[model samples]
Target: MTIPIALTIAGSDSSGGAGIQADLKSFAALGVYGASVITALTAQNTRGVTGIHQVPADFVTAQINAVFADLEVRAVKIGMVAELAVIDAIAAGLTRWLPKHIVLDPVMVATSGDRLLAAEAVEGLRTKLIPRASLITPNLPEAAALLNEPLAAGEAAIESQGRRLLAMGCPAVLIKGGHGQGAESIDYLVRDSGVIALAAPRIATRNTHGTGCSLSSAIAAGLAKGEDMETAVRYAKAWVSAAIAAADRLGVGHGHGPIHHFHRFY
Candidate 1:
């Protein structure tokens, strides 16, 4: 039995809502074997994060080496790297392994529109890591942060940002418009070929804590299963939409709860 495998290099959320937990859940839900390399440990629940303990850069490198050394990892999703050194270590690991697909969710901006990474770390990420990704998935504020521009309020501006980001060395960029106000949530997949707009009906629910992490991991799962970039992205969006639609049933947390990753089975 040849099961596809995907790796997630990210922080661990104690609440199991976001970060590494969400990534692993998304991988399993999508039928891909999951492996992980944790960069940090976060004290967080659905309400918010309270504390974080970053793993030492060398230890992070060790974890990455351990996973890549054993697993037949077909794709990788990266998230929540808190330090410049950690970013450097992750970039080094990617350079070593050369995974077929690398999905980078630039998890630098929070839902409250706050910067999560230090300025230097952000610069390191921009320079060293972004160029190595097969695709970068950035929310509106994150994309703006990467380009040091104002939030794009329309399609043309979003595409322009995507194009600029693509020039930053990533072959493709997914500009997610979840922060935008509308009946539909739209995400743009910008490649040299053109932009593909993926839209889904916006679900009204507070239980969306892990949406970005899960979406990117789902994309990794699809890629691990041998889907093309567009197909993987389309399937991920649809799957995440359904998970968000079904999130209310979980009743897990008081504020911004997690989506039901296993919504299909239970």
Candidate 2:
């Protein structure tokens, strides 16, 4: 049988750790075919994102259109869109040819503290993209930025934002707790029905590059395989934690690097 197809619309990371690269790695690990529409190009290594070039809106649109024309994509994971125009392009594409399953990661800043999306782009995301998502996976900082509301620390903050994100027109919200400085990485998933917390002890490692990209892409991969949203997110979290545990010691950057993508599945 042919592998299931999933599309990742994100920026390209030359480091091969985050963004489109990480998404591809995650999808492949989960036994899915991966496709991409690169929104921007980043010149960075494990050190950090040194330079970025945002693709024009027309170019982004063409890439998406070209892929959709040939691929029977089962799910979509959106990563970095650096400009308001890029967001508008994505919104237009989604409205015209809606993907069956859309997962928005709302990637704003990199773990290495490099700003990927423009500050102005966040507003466009709230207004245009959140409503179209099957789920929005945002770390605490991203959640706060999207809601334009300050949040208290820990699980309560994630839960609060998850609910508020639902109010913003998303069917579900996965407020990722990776950014919460704590012992356990607590991820909160909220739907119209209720909220579920997927908690695991955070693994201390320097190889955590592309983690957000991996988690969301894994969820998209799971959805492509016909899993439920809860099941998908839960499984994705477990995998990402494992990935962190097996992260290779790139030792190139001050920030966490990327986890090994070839570890044997437990």
Candidate 3:
């Protein structure tokens, strides 16, 4: 049987809660074949990131070339690029292959409050990678970092932030409202035409380690299965909400734990 393929270019989380591991799990959970190119290897757990070892930029390029050469990649999700060099390499590879759907999850900070991406790499992400994205999913801190401004104050400010991000050249931008104060989490998707608000009752759980990675990868999976942008976003939001709701069942680590990626199945 033919299967749709999705590629993730990111770091590796030793605890398997975020980065490449989370992205791959998300792809598989959504029924998309998953491939990966590791940009960095992180020594991290639910508590925090202890150390990080960046993969050589040339090796990162090689990995991307290998994947695109062999597989018919339908969608690509980018996350946790540690340095400017890695970002440059990824940008070059994406430019060459020109994947149909590119979902950029601007993962600057981890759930453990560890900074993942370097400050200098932010410019590379904005100028190079953002332009190539089919959609970008940025949390409040990430969005603020990208725009070099303070966090959006409320819903109206969030919508404005999304629009400003869209103006950066990405076709669409989703400013995740998880960090905002509300009974429900509301994500604003801003496109050139209009805005789409996706809301879900906030699931209270410390096991929310890989939420951003999973959400972006799930969106990529939906797009790979031929869903439209809005449809993909909605499906992804629902899936993540369910996963978050079921996360407490795992009872894994001492700190924040991972969501159940296969909650629908088992």
Candidate 4:
């Protein structure tokens, strides 16, 4: 049987709880073949990030080309792009290869309060990369950063920001409400058609290190398997919720452990 394939273009988390590792796990768990292009090497764990080494823009391009040269990369998920040059490289590669589904996760910060994206690169992300994406998954702060505004306060404000983000050139925006304060984590999937609110009960667990990466990759996996945007987002939300709920079962790290990406297995 031929399996659908998804690609992740992101950083490497030495801890194996986030970034490329998490993306691959999410793809496999969702029954998709996975490929990767590593953009950065991060010395990070559940607690925080201590060091980062960026891969040269040319090498990043090489990796991207190598993957697209052979693999049937149906969908792509991008995460933790830390430099302007790397962003440009990824954008150029995408233009050349043209993956059908692009899920851009504007991963700016780690769960343990470490900045992942550089301040100067944010502009590149806004102008060069965001437009090329099939969907952008940005949390509250990320959305605000993209808009050069304060964090949106309520659902109304959040939806408003999502709509404004759409004007930036992407066809759809998923303003994630995981950062919001509530018993329910509601994500707003705003398209030109309308807004879809996907809600899941917030599971109280510190093991949310790779939640965003996993969620975005899961969406990519679904899209690779031929599911539409809304269906993919809804399925990802439910799957992530279950993973978070089962997270406590795994005794991994000292803080902010990874969600059980294969929670359904054992």
Candidate 5:
């Protein structure tokens, strides 16, 4: 039987709520085979990240090479690149492989208010990685960091931020409104053609630790299965919403718990 494969290049969250672990789980939940290239490893839990150890950039490149040489990677979800070297390495690897669907989740901070990406690496991500991605999924803070402006407030400003990101060279941009104050969560998808707004009722829960990672990976899975950008994003948003709705039941961690990735299965 033929199986669809998706790749995640990110960090390792020991808590298993975010980063590579969450990405792999999302891929599996969506019925897509998952491959991973870990950029860094963190000693972390639900409470917070205590320490971090970055994998060598060359080693990251080797992992990418091995994956692309053997597996037919249908889509790639990139997250939590901590250093400039790692970003450069990932950019080089992507350029070499030229994967069909690239989902760049610009993971800058952890839910525990810990910064994941180095401040100096932001330029590398903006210049080297952003241009290569098919889509970039950035939350309010991340988007603001990229653009060097305050978080866009409300629908109109959010749409403008999305357009600004698109102007930065990424073919498409999804500006997530999860951080906004509202009864509903609104996400804007801006492309060269136009913008598509996605809204879902907000689910109040602390179990949203890995949400960004999960959503981006889910989108990659949808793309791997041959869905269009809009369709993939729509399905992914729905999947994440369901996961969030079911998250409170887990009760795994004391701080921000993880969403139920396999909520549909069990």
Candidate 6:
């Protein structure tokens, strides 16, 4: 039996908190073969992003080609698209390879409140990438970007928002409710069949920097291993919840930091 392959197209987190680093960590933790195409390299830490260096669009394409030409990648997760051209490059690569599943985590604002994607890239991502996604995972602010509406204050404040996102073209949508002011982190998954909601108590910690990226990547890893969507999400939610609970209080920042992924096994 061969190990299933999974690809993560995103940025690099120097602190190993978010973007490609976090995705790779989640994939390895989940026992999937992980590969990365770094879109941008950020001088980031738990404190925040101080500067960013975007890989040239052509190099990004080269990285994609290098991976797909050699590996039987089964699923892809896209995040931290630093520029419109990078997003276009990914779309072009997918146009040819057409992997079995694509999960788009519309990562716009960082946990530290730094802008990761250019303002112009949002529209391009919607038209070029969202439709290609088997699952589009967006938190409250990201849903607002997709819908062009003010964010719903909480989960109850936004009913059918996932349905609205599904209508936009993605076959399925997962609207994350972690950022919602609440005692629980409830995520609503909406598809043609109906809505499936999962709720768990929110941990009282700030080490949640890569929670979204980790969740989406674990889902992609699940898909690569041929798990159904619901099963993938169920496993991913449980995985991320465990990761969050085991977070390290190591950094001094107003915002949260990364978790200890291997705490249990180590």
Lowest summed-lDDT stretch of 10 residues in model 2?
248-257
Per-residue lDDT of 1-266 in model 6, one digit per residue for the tens? 89999999999998888899899989999989999999999998888899999899999999999999999999999999979999899999999999999999999989999989888998988889988899999998889877898887755545567888887688999999987877888898889998888888889888988889999999999999999999999999988988888885455355577876665576
TM-score between candidate 3 and the true structure: 0.99
Pairs that collide, model 6: none
1-266, model 5: which lDDT tens digit per residue? 78999999999999999999999999999999999999999999999999999999999999999999999999999999999999999999999999999999999999999999899999998899999999999999999999999988878888888888887889999999899888999888989898888999989898899999999999999999999999999999999999999999899889999999999998
Instruction: Give model 1's TM-score versus the native structure.
Output: 0.98
User: Could you give candidate 4's per-residue lDDT for residues 94-198 as a string of tens digits?
Assistant: 999999999999999999999999999999999999999999999999999999999999989999999999999999999999899989999999999999899
Q: Candidate 1's residue-wise lDDT over 1-266, tens digit each?
A: 89999999999988898899999999999999999999988888887777788899999999999998988999999999989999999999999989989999989754433345667888887899999999999999899989999999999999999999999899999999899879999999999999999999988888898899999999999999999999999999999999999999999977888998999999
Q: In model 1, which runs have C-alpha deviations exceeding 4 angstroms?
A: 112-115
Give all candidates' CA lDDT scores: 0.92, 0.88, 0.93, 0.95, 0.95, 0.89
Please estimate how well model 2 matches the true structure, expressed as its whole-model Cα lDDT.
0.88
Off by over 4 Å in 5: none
Please provide, for model 2 over 157-187, each residue's C-alpha lDDT reduced to its tens digit, 9 standing for 90 to 100.
6677788889989999988887777789888
Q: Say which candidate scores most in lDDT.
A: 4
- Residue-pair clashes per prediction, in order, are 0, 5, 0, 0, 0, 0
lDDT of 4: 0.95
Alpha-carbon RMSD, each predicted model: 1.0, 1.6, 0.7, 0.6, 0.7, 1.6
TM-score versus the correct structure, for each prediction? 0.98, 0.95, 0.99, 0.99, 0.99, 0.96
Task: Using lDDT as the measure, name the better of candidate 3 and candidate 6.
Answer: 3
